[model samples]
Target chain A: MEILNALINITDKGAGFLHSIPALLIAIPLGAAFLAPILFKLWKRLAEIITGLAVTACLVLAIYLVLFLGNTPIVYTFSGGNWEFIQNLLPLGIVFVVDKLAAFMLLVVSILVFFAYLFGLKYLERFTGLGKYYTLYLLMFTGMIGLVMTGDLFNMFVFMEIAAISSYALVAFGTEPEELEAGFKYMVMGEIASIMILLSIAFIYSSTSTLNLAHLSYAFTQMQTQMASTPGFRAGFYFVLILLMFSFSLKAALVPFHSWLPDAHPSAPAPISALLSGVFIKVLGVYAMVRILYNVYGFSWESSPEVFTALIVLGLASIIAGSLLALNQKDYKRLLAYSSISQVGYIILGFGIGNLFALIGALAHILAHALGKGLLFLTSGSVVYRTGERDLGKLGGGLGKYMPWTSLTYNLGALSVAGIPPFLGFFSKMFIILGAIDLARVWDSDPSKPGWTMIAVAIIAGLFAVVTLGYLLKITNQVFWGKSEEKRTLKESPFIMVFAMVSLVVLLLAGGVAFFFWLKPELLGPAADVLLKGTKYGELVLPGLFGAGG
Target chain B: MLILGISLVLILIGLYAIITKRNMIKVAVGFALMEYAVNFLFAIIGFHKVPGMKIIPPILMEVKTTANVLSSYSDPVPQALVLTSIVIGLGVTAFMLSLALRIYNRIGSFDLDEIKRLKG
Candidate 1:
């Protein structure tokens, strides 16, 4: 009876309750992460339950933030809020600025993580060291949630490392020669990304003398305007930005720097693969990059169209290279891995377009691809669980008969990824393609002339969606429906696995249509508005500087 | 400035080793070198230039220390950050070396060229 009251109290969402949430969002996972190993020693079963409960709590809190945290951002500073002497001295202490963008990310991560952990519980029955696996998984979870919430640039790098390091270990958890090698490759690339990011932070610190994102934004803008035509400063600025782009592109698996992904992603145990491909890259790579570029540095589409164009070139390369390369891959997971790169290209393309529709499409693609790729990877795990087969050509047709749920979910997920009707991916792709067309026709930074070159680029990008369909359909034909004769000894996956897969599919379908059509634009508008606000982000986080001084 | 130049040269050498070296252990070494070079830059950048004066520790050494002296204190923020970075570097290097050991246990070689089975 007492416990029930406590549970009810936990659900209470009041003004006081809401203020404490941003810190709890990070603290719960971080606490659980450290507690997991101890729980492992106490009781093997206890760890999984704790993880589930913690993840569910995170999801609930995230949803709370989404519902209540409207336009007014939540600024939770780590140190005392009284400001006292320290506050007047400087922008002291790490602050978590939970605006619409941050809240949206928290929601996306928690949903995907909750389902993936649900899937992992049943899926990881074959593996040993469940305790250690849960520990690292929780750590990575903490890192992901913390990465999104923190308002400090240096802290973001710290969380990024925590996530990156743990993931490298998780990728090699299988300990096979292939898995270890893949992990090594992944580590090398990931570490390089980290180093570059650290170097950038150092650069920012040297120039601005503040590591807080809001403060840095304020100072950086001040510096740029003051020395608008200084050649040396501009050169240095471009250098740092280019370094960041290269580093983050590597993290995002954008074409030229994407070699490690096909190997690293497929080589991980399937659930980790799902987490990595689905949410990890988007958070660590795309989200972080966008935050730094658009918000902190305050680069705008109108002022710096060149940077956006460079993003387009990268997106174009990834789309073309990723799709063309996946055509002949016989391995099932590897094909999906390559598909991830291609799918990610569309997200980058949306960012490249850099308008409201394009940005909305890109953010929506982040959601759609997260669920779609997650479902597909979970389906792959189910197939592996039942039959231990990963090769498309070798996996005979008749698979649907044995594993109806897995096959059905896979198809739903595949269709979504390929941008078919009703599923979330289609809507996201539609927005992106529409954004592309709009870019050529309407979104002209220079009003004197039409964007003719952009139309050709738009057309090519729009056509890549069909190419995506081609490769995905081939997977269906080859793996699940191909005519074959083999003594079939396969059964449907566990209830938990199927439930997780089906839930993702439902969410994918519901979320895609519901977001644009059913849900009020007020919710989605603020999210995209965060990006559109551009350099004004600093003003939102630290109003004293940008708000009053101007 | 001299320290920055030295660290930059060290970073270049580390990059060279990372790019050119085939041995997995040497590659790890290159990573360490690069990490140290970066760490060096972070630590040195915090030093406040006090003309003809000794470097003051960031701690409050005396009561009623002037605000000007407090403001002039070397940037302890980056130093604190570098400490965190070093610890992260340690965790990363330890995990990486363990991976190398495990890989060595399996294939009995540290040559990256030999462990190229995962290429597309």
Candidate 2:
């Protein structure tokens, strides 16, 4: 009975000091990042300790926020303790809104960052310039957290650049010829994308006369309803929206704009690769795009069917193209990177379907991929660390016999990613397929069109899931089932690496089995609700104006 | 409208260099050009040149009262935005230049075609 009361209290909306934790979430990391180099000069141990402590603290706060924002959003204004007055001038001050979606993302990113830091502690020992690596890594961490939490559009752009620039530097940290080339390519593409986004933001600011997300949403809605909307105004708004889509698609690595990802992901350090492949694209590219479209611009299938159709087409293309490309990769990390692109297609398709189940599926896929793909990358890194090999042809066959723990974890990861039953990926893929069918039914509201295209696309996506399994199983078979190549004995990875992989594997299994029972109600359901609410999100974040008027 | 068109043309020129240039330093210069174009556009967006009002700087010391300063001075917001964007552009340019230098050191050339060791 006492435990039940505590559980209820945990779910209740927090007040006072807890409300301020969102700011500290970004601040702690940013502060520690600046201090890391100075402390490194003092003692190498101190810098590592600070980074670990900062990430762990942020993770605890993230988990706390997830529970605290179960039903309520904390709208924090960065004013001089006079938010009451500034609340009326909503667009003037910088605001950080911690809703269920933001909290969910916070949980996803912090968990990955914390584990990656833990894994990198020993993994990075051989590399020089450890100080710079930790600094840039923390900066990247702070930028992503800020991106998800900021309520200002321009602030999002700023944080996005922070994340992008830091990542470009980290990708080149290896300083290899290939790494530098990949980093330069990524930097150029990323800069162009950011510039396009900035142009859109400028256009938006001109039209709406505000840079705050909530205010812009309110103003855009009002402008849509007003008869003063000219053809030129509509043209400009549509142009800005299209630019935003293109830019974000570039960042998200959705097929036509995904040329940079295959090179950049494989070129970075393995832990950074995991961070990039697992969460970076999702947060910087997918999450920001969704927020802008669904919440800021108020996208609905009934209202903007063309936009939804565009999303579906791009997603289908990515699903097919990314999978086919992954089949031809010789390098282990590049194959995984291409697979990341393919998995992201499922997310985009689910979101484009725009049903409750599909949105839930998309969010679930994000968590599943974060764990499964991150584990795969870490295991691959461990293999390389043990025996400096990245080629598939040279390092295969009976190696699994020597390192049974790594083999088991890799197989589990492969199984989960391939959507095997009772694993996390299976449930996410099931919901997405179901959601696609539901979308087809709704889209066929006009009797003339049968909506077979969407159904076919769903079928094709499932077939591609088979392709995913084919490739993953091929790796497993090639690596584990053949004759042993190395003459010396191989041992399991150290405890730190094993602990990281084991935690991810455990979560992946538990999420799959307990998805409907606990995960949905506690996490995924609320997150999808936030997306489904659409422009009603504006009211939730800023209650002074447009209160409860959907 | 003319200013916007000029800014668009400048952007196109920069993009042409970015897409067609093979030298890494040329690409970096192209990026700088694009950055400046955007900054110019931002300046035009915030420019307030009312014909009848007396022009003044945004600083309060230049004006006697609040009303005159409000009507005559520039909006200042876009200027601030341009300043911040310029700084960000500088950082990106510096980082890109450093990366280009490292690539040159690695391959002993600045041409991008020679740096194709990472192809599929």
Candidate 3:
């Protein structure tokens, strides 16, 4: 009764502002997406303008939300909006908890979506159904934003499905055989991953009797205490953890489970590909992994050594395997897709190292990779648009001669992803490798232990770095620098596309230099703190839901 | 228990069909079978055994205010989730069927091996 009173009091104090922000974030684009087709019927230009404005407004709103709740978490609850039946049945219908981490993710997603939509204005002209494309794109945007903000497990799954299904359709938008095949393969793998997630949720719900993440975390803590000595329960927990890790890793396309990405990413149109590689994988896979590990399962290296080892092993495998795969790819988009796998490996490795510096590196890498890879894919799209060629071997000639702006941005993007200094990627890689070394030093006192494994992984990461540099340079030389034997007909892409590419390049460089001043404390610090104090997350989220005193 | 066992068997059969079937349509049907098996499992998970489960009362009568009312209300959450999942499955299946039809139209075959535009 007292707890309920406290909750009511809290709501009364801040419910008006807090409750509306998340809904506004989700509803604006979703409503725009829905109205886009109708608006297109009346005036086609209005559809793009409305969507671009909606996304930009969302970006600004997210930035404001982040600044407003700097280093502080905001919890908002909506009890079915005065619907009597729902209110009576499910008193606590749904809640959205938007902390700094969610706000940061929302910012990243909205910015990317805004740019992608702007680019789509010109790029989507060739496609038959422009209105339908924007509609699906807006739906995808809503799902990602909602996924980041929602604090319920089932709601997250629903949002994830929304995003995944829309992406599958977008990938197959071309209706060509390759696109269809890629979409089919992507759907199959995605369905399997979703099933795994559903099964895991079913197990968790049956065990905890709740779907609210905060409540579930509370239940998990109580279960842990009561069954601390029970080996069977511990084993079951580990099994569920592995299930989640596997499912999320599949979504992230970490090496062994990465067969679908190279196909699916290359098959999608440029803007869609940008979304897929830039933010889709991060939201679906990396964000969920971080949330579950930090807030739900309460895992860290010091507490759960086995889980940490699993993460490290998987990250290393992806790094090495993705690099090797990229070395052999001749298709331009497929090569970029492989590089995405490798970059994701770097992010996962940073998280797996389980330190503050590593977490910062991981977050920074997500931001940088999104910009760099997004630019690369968009540039490739422009290249394909102008030349109608995807094979690297068939098309080679001074692209820089024809499209100077695109070549410049593409070079900057490649250099960034390859971790060249003065680009965004280098700072992130440096921090992550330094964190690994620090962790190794911490574990070195015990000579019989495998502390040297970190050093070995670090070396492998370095070697992969060189491999990435080699391929990126090879691509640059082949496509942009060398002259073709045959006469190649190429022209610069439309102004809008070039503008989008250039802006992203500028943002990437600026973000790289101003990492400390801009992103660190606002985004990275709080996220790292959440991960570092993993189990305390339960206490923070479910303050009155557990223990004897309650 | 019997329902659970049957659903497990159905899933195994679906898996077998998926692995052994050469026709794309058959493979798609196998996927449907698997989805049905999963849905059945979910429904079974929500089901509770009880006596006097049905009540045919007047339209506007006193509601049953018994302990059984609370105890016998099956897990409606999973049921709702399953309904949504079934609809999603239907959408995906329809899309796949159309895709298969398109492939057949283009390639003039139902054999999966012959419709191989994408390869390593």
* Model 1 misplaced regions, further than 4 Å: A1-15, A80-90, A443-450, A519-522, B60-71
**Deviation from native of the Cα of residue A381 in model 2, angstroms:** 0.5
Winner on TM-score (1 vs 2)? 1
Scored by lDDT, model 3 comes in at: 0.80
Q: Where does model 2 exceed 4 Å of error?
A: A1-14, A80-83, A226-229, A547-550, B53-73
Q: Give the Cα error of residue B54 in candidate 3, in Å.
A: 8.4
What is the C-alpha local distance difference test score of each model?
A: 0.85, 0.86, 0.80
Model 2: per-residue Cα lDDT over A438-533, one tens digit each: 877876996765688879978988899999988877677777667875676778778898888888898899999899898888899999998998
**Shift of residue A171 alpha carbon in model 3, Å:** 0.6
Return the top candidate by DockQ: 1
Q: Model 1 residue B105 lDDT?
A: 96
With a 3 Å backbone cut-off (N, CA, C), the pairs that clash in candidate 1 are: none
Clash counts for the predictions, in order: 0, 0, 0
* Pairs in steric clash, model 3: none
Give the TM-scores of the predictions, in the order they appear: 0.95, 0.95, 0.91
DockQ of candidate 3 against the true complex: 0.38
Query: How is the predicted docking of candidate 2 categorized under the CAPRI scheme?
Result: medium
Model 1: chain A TM-score against the true structure: 0.95
Order the numbered candidates by DockQ, best leading: 1, 2, 3
User: Order of candidates by lDDT, top first?
Assistant: 2, 1, 3
In terms of lDDT, which candidate is stronger, 1 or 3?
Answer: 1
